[model samples]
Target: MTVNPGHTFARIAIVTVSDRASGGQYEDLSGPAVEQWLRRAVAQPCEFVRRIVPDGVESVRNALLQLCDKDDIDLVLTTGGTGPAPRDLTVEATHQVLTKELPGFGELMRRVSLEQVPTAILSRQTAGVRGRSLIINLPGKPASIGICLAAVFPAVPYCLELIGARKMAEALPDSGA
Candidate 1:
């Protein structure tokens, strides 16, 4: 909690839940997209830790627990495995670890995403609080990552503050990508 105490920098983790990416069938672009978006939007010194886990409830659960409960990460952004596909279990895995389910995050994300594509409703992206960390499930596509973050990240700092994370501000600029 509070980002290692006395440290102004935030330690964030980007977990990519993709079987293909984890198995080296394809490169992971979603995780880096998250890092890039946060770097520009947060405007604070941040240390990012990236993890690639295969799509599954167990893998996602394990990775989230390790980062939120053990790694001292302030924020955990999970990409991939958020769709309605059989293997998209990120939301369920995230639910298992959360102390509070913030459904509004998913609602807002889907609402905004619907403006871009109708299939947005198929995404199960959600957010929650586990310990002092904020975990948010994001769509796997690089473009959708930015879209969802823009809709929800404005509240991330406040949510983190309420959850006893390090006090910080997010300067979210217009994500004109």
Candidate 2:
């Protein structure tokens, strides 16, 4: 995975797992919210790919596989389908494709969300590594997206570097030129 691709930029894929969003019952706000947050937090240029999938194991799992395996995305962020409901299956789908499970990401997100809402305990957010890509499951609400992301995003760049997703120094343009 040549994450740098001769430039200091990142390719991020946002997958929104929601039946309502996918079925056009409502607009996909959560996906856009994640994109907005990343654009503000990340310094480097970013190319974003967005997808909406219904809430199910197969739908979420297939989307994740395509993004992680075929899209060459450096980071994949999924919103929705992490709750305790019967339809919630983002965590399970994510687990199916991950080579390494990073439990800390979910723990930190739940802990931070718990501070804002007691029901946060029901959220089952998780994160893991698939090949060179890092995939994270986040709560569905647009309001909660920023809170959870802020809690975990500080480590994202470092995690990506550790996973060989990108090298900070290599990604930088040569100043001597």
Candidate 3:
């Protein structure tokens, strides 16, 4: 999973799960926001592969598998489909893809979000690891995506390391505090 040698950029997949976006009913703001955040935060070059999938377990699961297995991506950030609505199935899809569930990520995200809005408790956002790829589900709103990513991004490099992703240290600077 280490990015192949000689490559300066980390390969990342940004999956946006929204029926409307997938149907072309609206532009995907959250996915772009995730990419923007990565560009600013990583300090290293990143190859972001973006996907828009309808809100469904099968669609999300398929997209995730393809990104992690075929694309060999190091990280997958999924925005939208994380709420309690009838169509929100990002969590279920993530569970089907990841071998291990990282509950602490969700807990920390909700805790940080709770400070701003009491309804943050309703968010089902979570994170997990599929092979060497670390997948994190984020809220749909662009602003919320920024908030949640900032809260959890510092630990991403270490987590990817534990999952055996190579070349991460050079690509993702931790600036250990």
Best by lDDT: 1
Where does candidate 3 have its weakest 10-residue lDDT segment?
A: 168-177
**Cα TM-score of candidate 3:** 0.91
User: Residue-wise lDDT of candidate 1 within 41-101, one digit each (tens)?
Assistant: 8866788899999999999999999999888888899999988899999999999999999
Model 3 C-alpha lDDT per residue in residues 54-107, reported as the tens digit of each score = 999999999999988878788899999989999999999999999888999999
Best by TM-score: 1
Superposed by TM-score, candidate 2 places the C-alpha of residue 83 at a distance from the truth, in angstroms, of 0.5
Candidate 1, poorest ten consecutive residues by summed lDDT:
168-177
lDDT of each: 0.90, 0.86, 0.86
What TM-scores do the predictions have? 0.94, 0.91, 0.91
Least accurate stretch of 10 residues (summed lDDT) in model 2? 168-177
Query: Clashing pairs in model 1?
Result: none
Candidate 2: tens digits of C-alpha lDDT, residues 38-151: 777776677799999999999999998998887778889999999989999999999999999999999999999999999999999999999889999999999999899888
Model 3 local distance difference test score? 0.86
Clashing pairs counted in every model: 0, 0, 1
